[model samples]
Target: MDFSENFLHYVWRFRSFDSAELKTAASENLKIIHQGFLNANAGPDFSNAKIQLDGTIWVGNVEIHIKSSDWLKHHHQIDDAYNSVVLHVVYENDVPIKRKDGTTLPVLELKNRISTELITRYERLFLTLTDFPCINQIREVDQLVVDAVLSRTLVERFEQKTGAVIEMLNNLNGNWDETFYRFLARNFGFKVNAFPFEAFAKAVPQQIYAKHKDNPLLIEALVFGASGFLNDEFTEAYPKQLKAEFQFLQKKYNIKPIDATMWKFMRMRPQNFPTLRLAQFAALIIKANHLFSKIMAITDVSKLRMLFEGLPVNDYWKTHYHFKKQAAAVSIQFGKTSINNVLLNTVALFLFAYGKHTATQSYINSAIKLLETLPAEQNAIIERFTGAGVKIDNAFGSQGVLQLKKQYCDEKKCLSCGVGVKILRSSSNHH
Candidate 1:
């Protein structure tokens, strides 16, 4: 099977070829002293490579390709960047190559040099349809390799999450409190109504809520009205009162509510309904005057839990799911799972983003510690990794596994992954 240039880079970077039998296409004995650093940007594939050809030691950039003719095909001959390329590596020596100065360039063919076992392992990984490309081989890989990769991937996942937070920060003009409020609003909606909740938060700016934050009733009215929940007539006294309050605030602030149809409730638990989430959000807003500051000051998880739990939903919501719909008097208190979800998605990410913005190591460390302290997330992706013999002890590992699966494994980027590299390097010995 024909492989990509990336595969060649992987082989060359790892020295996966038979070094003892190395020879150029023109019959010159060759030895690689150093493979050099792989270049991420344009120019050469590798730079500062040291290769001993015959008796002369050449030091310069190294370029690799599937075919020797790719040198001209890529128009590198006319480009001055290829002038320093001391060694040309190819899988197929299709044609002789000459530099811009009319001198024949030495070519090293890897077709016969690369181990068959390595090719097989690479093919197996790239061609597989499994949930994870390395699922079958993951069990055979060393635990140390898995640990190191997971550790790296955990940081990668945090950085990925940090990107979203950074963008939000940028949009909010570096307003940490506003950004955190928007993020919390989205998480409150969870997966089902996240978009609408986000829209509601954006529509009713944090400044508006800060004005009347002392009054929980007014806050709920604004939130519920801006969510389009108070648009319809209600038989319940609480709904009518909220509607009245919201109508007054809506005109004062010139605020617009999001489309009610955008909020989804099908197949979701009644406790997770959009109305209930909005009510809970208003309660949290009322209790935590400076929400972000209050969160940053506390390190205890129980205190954080209490901060979320102590703020009970309005009495109307305690026995109702929607405006007029009355359910059994089951308490609508924030459950442990919902609280943890906020901690994981909102609080932890807020800490990380704030730490990054302030360049404070302690907050960053706190963010990581918070993730480690939290329980692992329950989802299909984590379950698949567990089934594949990978141990996930906390949110850190689970988050890393999630990043690994989504970014690297799903994209078939095995060469860039530590676990994939380990598996490829060990395959030769196994065969």
Candidate 2:
């Protein structure tokens, strides 16, 4: 008799019940023609259910509860949304309920009809200690079911990413190029410096950089200066020259730089330093004129990777990770992993947003296709799933797994997850 409303939701969703002996509290035969859609937002538990009571067919919302007394507990008796509820389903029909119109409502109790095995399985799934309730049983789920879930989660992830992009687009006044520039700059910083990089990009608008885009050094100076990196004293000629150039540009453009302390360097690899990332971003800007247009035209993943790979930091950056610091001389080109991250996070999301904004299917398809071609991201969450025997072949699966973790597993919304439903319905023999 003790279970979550979500468990009841799952039962009603899949009709996991003995249909032959279904009857109301008053013993009237109840027939379920349709279970209806589960509503996540509000109003009803299930919408548009088709049910037959006695000899009359009813079509309306269906509300569920653990006990029929919950009808007054939730105050649905006074709320008008419950007025259309044709049938009330519950585990225990302890009391009679009425509609907002003061008419008696029929109730079907599930306590006698639901399998004991299903209840035991539900309790096990919902009361587990693992990060994912189904971690032990996920491997037992059908690969086809997993695939279907992953495919749906992938679309969910895309929609979530596209939603963020749309917000950025609105903030940028519907300028796709500006939105793309900000997103690209954020990815260039990766996780370590994304915040400062985003702040720096906003401080120095893309239009300002587009003016000096013809010259890579000027672009580098502008980016570094607006990032507040130029404010520090440097013993090297390269940084000193950059500082001098930025001073002139800053005054000419009336630019205000972000706080240098905002950029993080402690405990970060030299290759991922903000200075190095900014230089690479500058180089990318120099090479990729009308970047948004170029990205939209390219459909091949290899060519997309090639575009990022071709970016090379200035000669000064070849020997230096920072202004005063020097490291072994190596070409400061963006690594494959970094490029993949950019493509996955920035380029793909941008493509999706562009597709949605313009109603272009090709761009949306290109976004999905690009993720399919890329390798699966190596991260703690993906590794966790991998250790649990979940197969993730590419970024498509990786994105889906991320969505599943954040939206379903982490939130403990197991009843709404496909894998969770499968595990709960498989059997009650779980150890």
Model 2, 1-431: lDDT tens per residue? 66888888888887787777678888898899999989877898999999999989999999999999999999999888899999899988899998878788999888877888888777777677666877877899988888789988988888877888899889888888888998888888888788999999998888887788778778889989999989888888888888999999999989999999999999987788888888889888888866998998887756887788877578888888788877897658888889889999988888877888899999989888999989999999999889888999999999999999999998888887888888877763331
Candidate 1 local lDDT, 316-407, one digit each (tens): 88788887787887657778889988988888888877888789987788888888888999999999889989988888788889889889
RMSD of 1: 2.1
- lDDT of each candidate versus the true structure: 0.87, 0.86
Model 2: weakest 10-residue lDDT segment is 422-431
Off by over 4 Å in 2: 100-102, 232-236, 428-431
Candidate 2: lDDT of 116? 87
The local distance difference test score of model 2 is 0.86
Q: List RMSD in Å for every model shown.
A: 2.1, 2.6
lDDT, residue 331, model 2: 59
lDDT of 2 at 75: 90
Per-model TM values vs. the true structure = 0.93, 0.93
